[model samples]
Target: MATGWLCHELYMWHNTGNWAQVFPPGLTVQPGTHAENPETKRRFRNLVEVSGLLNHLVQISPRPATPDEIARVHTREHIAHIKALSDAGGGDASWLTPLGAGSYEIALLAAGGAIAAGEGVVSGEVTNAYALIRPPGHHAQPNLAMGFCLFSNAAVAIRHLQARLGVGRVATVDWDVHHGNGTQAIFYEDPTVLTISLHQENLYPPNSGSISENGTGRGLGFNLNIPLPPGSGAAAYRAAFERVVIPALHRFKPELIVVPSGFDASGVDPLGRMMLSSGAYRELTHLLLSAARELCGGRILMTHEGGYSEMYVPYCGVAVLEELSGVKTHVDDPWQPLMMAWGGQDLQPHQSLVIDKVAALVARIS
Candidate 1:
């Protein structure tokens, strides 16, 4: 029942500058609104405040992830590039995913938190855990940070377990509404680590995750990508898990499960067209919990991914935390706002096609 929270002060140290606003913004009021640390802090604090499970949380103070630790999953050249960018000025404006002043410490803290979560799982300090890490990690590749991601946090954790803790079989499920191309690439040729990314296709990073981009060499079939179209709601995500994710895991039977948690799939979020609500996140967490209980010794580590709607993301995040910690917290309008969204702008025929296409694609895959 112990749930380790690999959180440090630097989780919110990353401050987005003006560049992200110009290219592709985040999920809040406008594109660049969610780019600020205060926005993430506001919503994240809401979830923690309501949950009352703060007692169960483990606070990992800020610290740097060593170059060797990073190299476990990322390419040395990529690391060098990011370091140069981080050091050149204060941010990385080229990709619109800039880092603010003091962001270097923040990135280290985020990376450290993920590694701490991995340790928690290995040492049996918790049945499962979630690292409320920031500077989302799914979009980061071995050498670069795209899509507001600075490091491949989940992939790095996997490498830590394999090299540092001697874990053999590891699996990561990324439900970020965008493809986890970086994670897949890190373990693309490694059979020991399995990555399952079920995302809304054609969203960001246009052509990243496709069914045909399965793993290569020894890692063949270890990487599974289920790309859902826009507007896919609770049903599609859950069905993908039951049909493809769970089945694959049940058959592969890994020792640990990790989720790159992202709430951008919520209906209110501007980055995505998915109709998933707070309730949907809870259900998805429940499904993962069930699978973990049945297969992977109930070990799960969810590192923060993406979720833009400041108002809505907190609610959805709280919902998932509630399911994970078995803590029932009551918050007002949490469920109402998202439910309201589905009925208002989400049901338009154009959006509905997105859901239908996702369903058809899943049918083809599973």
Candidate 2:
């Protein structure tokens, strides 16, 4: 079993409609352009092909998730609403989620792609997998699509593994720049799945992903949030993973590992303020891969979540896939020097203090 990659052309076409890159387009905003376009992701696919990385891994074709599979994670009402909107020639399904004609089908494909990746990992058809899906799903709540997400892809994939494959004790580590509020919400009170998110503090949707907002009820200590301050870079992220993420996974001892892979944390991303570079992403992937090997027999799956940098996301993803597949490439990140010079790559006393706070929570859960 080798590393598997799942993607579909339709994924690049799940349009999120035109909107101002920054709010209030009438004032100082560029002309309305589709906030979510296929360029960034399509370019990622192109990079992989041109760099010869695509030939090294098994490519898994995606199928649309059944309504039943979607219903396992999302409400039927929400599903109906989205389908109805798609039927009406497109509209905003919810907050940041937009759809065009037939997008409901494409969204299904994205969720299905995630499930297929999970299937490959669990079935031993692939040692591990990466589902490069779009209309990222970490921010999708059961009833609302808050962050350019229509369905909770990770949740749906997790549910499929649990219900169909009887796979148990799953851990999801979301490192998207914005909080993975929806993934956190879906498993908030479930102890079987341990949800950990390392994100920018108070960034998106506002008032979410606080460290104090750990799991509730039976899942009291199951969810962990490491909300790093803005400008946090590679060192800060490494510290958080070592102090919080790796330790939490070790303590939980999950059977399989899933990551909501988002490149929005990169220094050059338009939507985030963090300073993570391609090296940061590669190191993060290496750390998670190590933990997965130690705790779960190297069974790990990463489904693409959020990444907005059209020029740099491809390289970021290439770095991650290289580590995941154990494939080497000569393709270099052209902006590495500039990003390294952007500073914040080193750990700071203030960053250590923040990490220490989250590290303390590990003890509580342990």
Using lDDT as the measure, the top candidate is 2
Q: Give Cα distance to truth, residue 236, candidate 2, Å.
A: 0.3
Residue-wise C-alpha lDDT for candidate 1, range 1-366, written one tens digit per residue: 777766655576677765343354446534444343457545676567666757656554435678788878777887776677667666563465777766655676677778888788777878788788877788887777788887888888888888888788988889888899889888888878888887887677877887777788888778888777676777667667766777777777788998999888888777778778888888889998899999877889888888877778888877777788787766554565547455432334544444344334333221
User: Candidate 1's error at 16, in angstroms?
Assistant: 1.5
lDDT of each: 0.74, 0.88
Clashing residue pairs found in predicted model 1: 26-31, 27-308, 78-143, 264-307
In order of appearance, the predictions have TM-scores of 0.87, 0.97
- Model 2 C-alpha lDDT per residue in residues 42-135, reported as the tens digit of each score: 9898999988999999888888899999999789998999899988999777766667888888889999999999998999888889999987
